[model samples]
Target chain A: MTDRQDRKAFFRELGKYSALGLEMALSVVIGMGIGYYLDRWLGTGPWLTIVWIGLGFAAGVRSLYRAAVRSGKDLERDEERRRKPGGP
Target chain B: MRKAILVLLAVAALPATALAAGGHGFSWFMMLPGGERLFYMYAAVFIAVFLLVAAAVVVGGKKTEEMVIPDPRFTLRNLFELILGFLQQLAEDIIGHHYKKYLPLLGTCFLFILFMNLIGLIPGFLPPTQKMNVTLGLALVIFLSTHYFGLRENGIAYLKHFLGPVWWMAPIMLPIEIISHLARPMSLSLRLFGNITGDHAVVAGFMALIPVVVPSVFMGLGVFVSFMQAFIFTVLSMIYISGAVTHAEEH
Candidate 1:
């Protein structure tokens, strides 16, 4: 990557990585909150909570996987940029 | 130089250890009740920053020719220009071709959050971003704007991403997408709130322990943290906006 592109990419990557842990944790909390509300409204005791928490965990892992894939692609791009020293 | 840094780090670590022990002593204006305190604090900071920006603009606007020529010395106008220039570059790189349209929002977020965070470094003034409501409010605005721009760009197709690639996967993908989307704002708010509150608390704790030289190190750290948190928030917002606006082309 060119110097400017490299800096930009570094900032973007930093933001993405920093947010990942908090995002995953919140994903679970949001899922639980949604599940709890649905359970309360429908008078289903624990079933919805169970299901939603499961869904939330899945969502958390899914996002982590997506970020992993993105970083992998980014690394590949960086490698390509390195191979062609002068090209942007 | 290494020994000096190590001593600085050791001084910094003392306060952090104090932070862990959980004794903080800092007071703001005691007139307001607990619930409305953050609101008033945020408003005061908002007005102060607004006035500062307005003054800078008015002064800078007075001489149109001078605006073109760079200032010989560091000045408020130069600082503002530097920040805006950096944000412009960031927007261009992250948001791509239509980056100009989003510069105003990104710039506002950067400046507002940066000022709010910086205010915490001053003794007796708490940063509003330390409050959950303030940070969450800011995050929600970014959240709403991201979707609004996405909808404007892609119409109804923007919602289709939530439904996954295949029709059969919609049930699974929809909830996961919703959870993840909701998490973005929550995480944004939480990270800002936690960092500022923690930083402020550490500074306060150190101030209570020893009034003189010790607190300054943590205050310096506070300054760095404030800039970092603000930058991270803006960068994330830019990433989100770019993702929303450009997702259509990729998928």
Candidate 2:
């Protein structure tokens, strides 16, 4: 592939990953927000929000961590392949 | 023809015995007790099934390699090859070139889900996909996998995709986009869970009440719904992955 095409492909892959990360982070925030508002309306004194939001945050972090670890592994694999003869 | 009629007569009498037995042959999983405990069972079942299938595939592939079977006439290996070939075609069609890299993840998700859905059709078995935890776990994997690809492709600049096109709209668009993004997993998980659960429940209820030829119609509907849910989940995942992999410049 030409440099421009390669760059485009790279960007496209980047966009995909970014969108996924954003989706996950947003899920947590919205989950927490909904819980918080519901608790407030129900006179639950922020307990529901606190707990749900915590869960949401935990879920988000877990997703992010997994993504990071997978990416790291992929990078290592690529590096190893590059070091070997006749690597792509 | 006379023997067939006699067999049909005996088959018709079987349900009476089954009904008289009581309990409907359903295990504890069907009870669906309150709280999130059901989620744990769902996760455990999903993981167990996944591991079992993975191991089977590995062992079966090795066994097939060692076998001296001459003809490729409809064996398990051939069946797997057919499935993998179809999945590869599907991946290429949906995701374009270099789709081989994604075949493992996407194919596994699709097949696992499809099998889980079909499992519900068995008399006593419950489809793990009918539960929220299983669907959620699959959604979580897709969600994370997309980001892993994104960050790997662009490093820190991957975050820029979330900022939107215009700088001013970032404030408003970010939250809206985020809400929609968050909804993807919820929608993915809940849509599969609700459809499968509802379909299975309807069939069970119908079988309980009518206990006759009527439940078959609902069972047909359940079958259709199960396939549709699997298709929807796979298509949506592809869409999400394609959207992530598409370059902002192209837009």
Q: Which candidate has the top score in TM-score?
A: 1
For model 1, the docking class works out as: medium
Model 1 bad stretches (over 4 Å): A1-7, A78-85, B1-59, B63-66
Worst 10 residues of 1 chain B by lDDT: B20-29
List, residue by residue over A3-83, the lDDT tens digit for candidate 1: 877787788789889989998988899999999999999999999999999999888988898778767876786688679
Per-residue alpha-carbon lDDT of candidate 1 for residues B188-236, written as tens digits (9 for 90 to 100)? 9999999999998887777777855788899899999999999999988
Candidate of highest lDDT: 1
* Ten contiguous residues minimizing lDDT sum, candidate 1 chain A: A69-78
Give DockQ per model, in order: 0.77, 0.11
Chain A TM-score by candidate, in order: 0.86, 0.65
Backbone clashes in model 2: 4
Please, what are the lDDT tens digits per residue for candidate 2 over residues B1-251? 99999889769866653552244435445446641346336534665687577658645655555655534576655665666776665556446586777777887787778778877766656677876778898999998897777677567777776767789977654544555557677767877788888888787777777665777798788787876677667666775675577544345
For candidate 2, give the lDDT. 0.65
DockQ versus reference, model 2? 0.11
Best by DockQ: 1
Candidate 2 residue-wise lDDT at B190: 75
Evaluated on chain B only, candidate 1 has a TM-score of 0.83
